[model samples]
Target: MLKDFKPTLFILARFILIYLILLAIYQYFLNYYSGTGLDPYSKMITEQVRYIQNYLGYQTQLYNDIKNEQVYFYVRNDYPTRMVEGCNAISVMILFIAFVFAFYKGLKIFTFIIISLILLYILNLLRITGLNIIMTDYKEYGKIAHDFIFPSIIYGGVVILWLIWIKHFVLKDKVSNELKDKI
Candidate 1:
């Protein structure tokens, strides 16, 4: 019975350990940029969003709100969205990275983690851009779009990536071990 639960306990422990370590690092990062009113991550994300929106032919402007530590996104002179630390998606990336490392199989997993993080980052950029466009063009739907639709898209992307990693890495290793035991 003890043996039966050992693997489950180990996995849980690993997950929690990795999650806490990564979260601590993230908190430290936020603290380091707290009073400065200039978070590099948020700034980079805002710039990317601006580039993306401009490339899509939507004339946009960015205003740094130093007091609030946020960047507002203006579309055609209307402030429709703001980019903050949360909007930058580093938290989401941290969570994803924690999960991937918790189930670490080999060094090759690093490559997969990097690729997945890049995809997730791109997905988040698109989500923010789309949300800004929708909010600017459709004010009445802004609440639902921000509160429901955009969250679903970014989180759903994370779930899909997790499933892919589990299927290709974790479960594959487990199945191989089981086959070896049978042989």
Candidate 2:
């Protein structure tokens, strides 16, 4: 039964298990620190971003005067990368999940988690930067890019990366062996 089971599927299951465990840990910390379900890491990034905006001259002086609370301009959807409330956290979670899945399936340790994570992070940063450029250049199309195009880019890259890893690395030898054995 084990022999017949596709190695890629087995590895994917392993990845899911690892991902779930990490997600649980992150959730615990987030809740403990924030008094809410929001991810603490994301919150920190947002706060830092808000600070930067003030330095960039986007602070609202009226709000600062009236409420003594600095109000800064925030382009909520400008860069999908900064949408830590969902996109960033979810992508981070998925990276770990993909790593575990690939690792359990017999992928090389370096290729399994670290390389995959590095690839994802680079792409994620590009996505964020691209979104920012789009927002700056063409405000009208920013929403579509943020809501649809960028996500498709990230997810599509993930799918292709996993498929390639399984095809060329993990299952490559086993599939070849089966064919040779059959012959």
Candidate 3:
């Protein structure tokens, strides 16, 4: 039993090692950017959200409040949402890219990574805009929407993409298909 599982375990180990290294490198860059005064990732997310709001004909404004030292923006009046590091979706992009790197390191991996990152960023901006709209109109559902519903959509999308990669790249490969036959 253990002999048969060795390859799977080894693959798992490699996944962990590579994923952590990639995630660390990503975090380092994110931190480096944030350390320079304004966090570009979060700032972009805020701006993108603002753009979406404005596109929809909402009155939007971006500003910094010095007393409390928070950088945020307003939408649909003075309704504000602060742009923080977590809202940037860097963490999700890191995880998405890590899974791709771990599963298959083919020539097309770079293309897949770029496409996945773009899709995730777009999804996140749409999520934020939808949440802002929700919070603006139906305050009672805001907490549930932000805390549970929206995260499920983003993370669930990642899970689906991972499964697609596995189906198309991993299981379709000759060696992995042989392993699947044995298992």
Candidate 4:
């Protein structure tokens, strides 16, 4: 029988890769004026959504009225934003590591990985856009969605990508056959 694929390398490489990528992006953002240029031009989208919500006078006083519940690493509005930020960090690293693993393991590097990365980033922007809309439309549920639910959706996507890479490219029957022989 084939051994289960361990996420240790995937996880570790993801951490290092994402840290470096974030450092580069942070430096770029610092050197470049306006946070507007950073993401999929979503600043405008978020702004428009927020403006529309405000203009509609749909005052759902849910978020404003609730007293924040205390939890580790959670302080009021900080948790949702933090979760989104963490997802960004994790997603970048996961993509980078997956690409490297695929390439090193003799898979089509640029064709599969580059396209997947682009799609991942696009989907990420969509997630952010949806989160922005939700945060505005349902102020009361913002914390629940952003802090827990939204991050899960994004992480779920990353897991699915990893599974695809493993099933089709990385840990294929050939790999399992070799491992069985060696064992």
Candidate 5:
């Protein structure tokens, strides 16, 4: 009975362990910079967003409200977009990483994980940039765009990446093994 469930149990345990460990490290990182304005990663992300806005010809200013631990981006002196720790997408990245590590295959997996993380980061940046634009020009639709559309884009990207990994790496290996056994 136990033997029958061994693989399933192992995968579940691995996923939980990796997710918790990564989450703990992330929490410690946030706590370490609790008193400061914004954590370094979040600040970096905000800075990149500022640059993107500027390049897109929007007059942009970044105000770091250290007291509240929030960064606000002002565009063309209009409504500002508030950026917090969650805006940086570290949590999403952590989830993506945990799923990848849970289904660890081989050394090649590291490359895939790195590439996926980079793509996820870029996707987040674009998401934030688009959100800023929406908030600035179409204030009425900001709520729906932020609350529903943007999150779906990021999470959808993660799901697609997970599917690619399982299909290309995990399932491929299983199929190959079955083929070998048949022959």
Candidate 6:
């Protein structure tokens, strides 16, 4: 009875460890940057998205909103949409890191993670840019695009990256051996 629970417990422990560490890092950034004169990372994300939008000849306007004397970032491409903290992709990246770390600890995990995160950040930028473009170009589909498709691109890419990590880096021999022992 206890033996069967071991594998589940191992998985849970790995997941929790990864999650807490990543969450701590995320929370640190959130708190450290919250009450400052500026949030450098959030501004970077907003600027990157705006640069891409501008490169594609979509004029964008960026401004800050202050509530309780704390600054919030926002961008507009015709219609205004606030880029409020969550839109910056840090949370999604944190979740991605946690998920990737949970599954396998094969050699080069950090290498793969760093490269994957860079790619994911680019994809997230594209997702942000695409959503704004959709708002401008495909007005009729704007709701569904915002609510469904663009997010799917970022999250779906995470799933694909997870699969790639498992298939390419993690050894089949080790996995099968673990499976054999667990079973």
Estimated TM-score per prediction? Answer: 0.95, 0.62, 0.84, 0.51, 0.97, 0.82
Candidate 3: C-alpha lDDT: 0.76
What lDDT score is found at residue 7 in candidate 2?
A: 70
Query: Which segments of model 2 are wrong by more than 4 Å?
Result: 1-16, 35-82, 89-103, 179-183
Candidate 2 C-alpha lDDT tens digits along 1-183: 767777757767777777777788766765574534335455444454445444644331211111221222234433322344464535454664657464545546455657767677667656755665566557899889998999888888787777777677667877888999999
Rank list by TM-score: 5, 1, 3, 6, 2, 4
Encode model 1's per-residue lDDT on 23-71: one tens digit a residue: 9988998898888775998798889989999999899889999889999
lDDT of 5 at 162: 98
Pairs in clash, predicted candidate 5 = none
* Model 6: colliding residue pairs: none
Count clashing pairs, candidate 6: 0
Q: Each candidate: what lDDT?
A: 0.90, 0.58, 0.76, 0.51, 0.92, 0.74
55-105 in candidate 5: lDDT tens per residue? 998778899899999899989887558899988989999998988888899
Shift of residue 176 alpha carbon in model 6, Å: 8.1
Can you tell me which runs of candidate 4 are displaced by over 4 Å?
1-103, 176-183
- Quote the RMSD, in angstroms, for model 5: 0.9
Put down candidate 6 lDDT per residue, 1-183, tens digits, no spaces: 989999768867887898888889888877786765336776677788878888888877666554432232233425535466766677778877777677666667789889999998899888878877877777788789888998888889888988887786655656788999998
Give the clashing residue pairs of candidate 3, or none. Answer: none
TM-score, cand. 6 vs. native:
0.82
The 10-residue segment of model 2 with minimum total lDDT is 60-69
Error of 4 at 50 (Å): 9.4
User: Which residues of candidate 6, in runs, are more than 4 Å off?
Assistant: 36-38, 68-77, 171-183
Which whole-number lDDT from 0 to 100 does residue 84 have in model 2? 40
Q: Which pairs clash in model 1?
A: none
